[model samples]
Target: MPDLQRTRDPERWDEEEPPTLTTDVTIEQPKTIITRNQSPDIAFDRSINAYRGCEHGCIYCFARPTHAYHGLSPGLDFETRLFAKPTAAALLRQELDRRGYTPAPIAMGTNTDPYQPIERQYRITRGILELLLETRHPATITTKNHLVTRDADLLSAMAALGLMVVNVSVTTLDRRWRAPWSRGPRRRASGWRRSACWPSAAYRSTSSSRRSSPHQRP
Candidate 1:
């Protein structure tokens, strides 16, 4: 892998501030979007990752190592460099329309976050949800970003059909630890309120601490 870091001359280092790392996104046109898995340890058989790298920068993210496959550092580069699948929804539509296609619950955010920061611009995940809703297909989403709530309309519609479920992962409630650990996801309170917007939808919480539990608005 090449040096992704920006270096400065020794004498100028004292005079100039260190360069800041910025996120860069590369568009990838994949022939297919759905990934099939048959691992007995996994709960879902198929999954879709709208983005390749997660901006959340979770220290313990299992997907970090995947960046190594692209000749990039699995540390900082994994968070700064990302790949988006703009054609995912189109490809998925084709796959769903295939003659012998079978419908099962497609999973999102299994490898990387679908609603990561970049999704705000690309809106690839939202397109996928629209397609799924059109086809009346089932899907399951797991995310740490509150951006997922932006699709509450789609989610609630699917939920009314008993076709959608969401899992929100909360690593910590304390901002002191959370700020340094997962750099992008919002605070627990905000995420809880946004998640609650999905009426009648099945919501689950995954947390490292037992103290972090699901908060329902009654």
Candidate 2:
């Protein structure tokens, strides 16, 4: 594929149809799972990223730029080629077991969507959640997939102790307002409402006050 948009000195073409984007997941064993940040702009000091790439294919996703460091295109490659940390749960356990490990809310899906399709196979997100519940650790999550509902049993338990917060990233309720990156028909407007029902008892869903994109219609 040619770097048509960002590069000017590009001359590569094979007169072939562009390859269809199919998600390719690579299992990665990370040395650590809990990422610490000291940025004043961020609310949480610690966070977890079970995966490095997102399959949502959201063109406007701010995380896309991070893919460039892996020598991958920030466009299709960012969405089709993904990485997973299967050891996230174990690493999290080690961290929490460490001396002086305080009980503060840990954020999930900070860099990439944790509930992306590959999560079903890796189950990394839920694995970490289970460990959090066992330790009575506070947690926070943001996701667009309805699969989060699957962990209602765990999340509800965490919320009961005020140890969990969840956010379902729904841009709008308009049934027709889907971008090219939208996940299939299953994510149609109704899905957001369905997500609300799934997590009400599990955790509070808090969305920012930011309005919809200016490019989108009311």
Q: Which candidate number has the best lDDT?
A: 1
lDDT for residue 15 in candidate 1, whole number 0-100: 46
lDDT of 1 at 136: 98
Reference-based lDDT, each prediction: 0.80, 0.76
Model 1, residue 6: what's the lDDT? Answer: 66
Could you say which candidate leads in TM-score?
1
- TM-scores, in order shown? 0.81, 0.77
lDDT string, candidate 2, 73-106, tens digits: 9988888899999999999999999999887889
- C-alpha RMSD for every candidate: 7.4, 8.0
- Where is model 1 more than 4 Å wrong at Cα? 1-20, 179-186, 197-218
Off by over 4 Å in 2: 1-20, 184-209, 212-218
lDDT of 1 by residue, 110-174 (tens): 98888887899999999999999999999988877777878989997887887887777766555
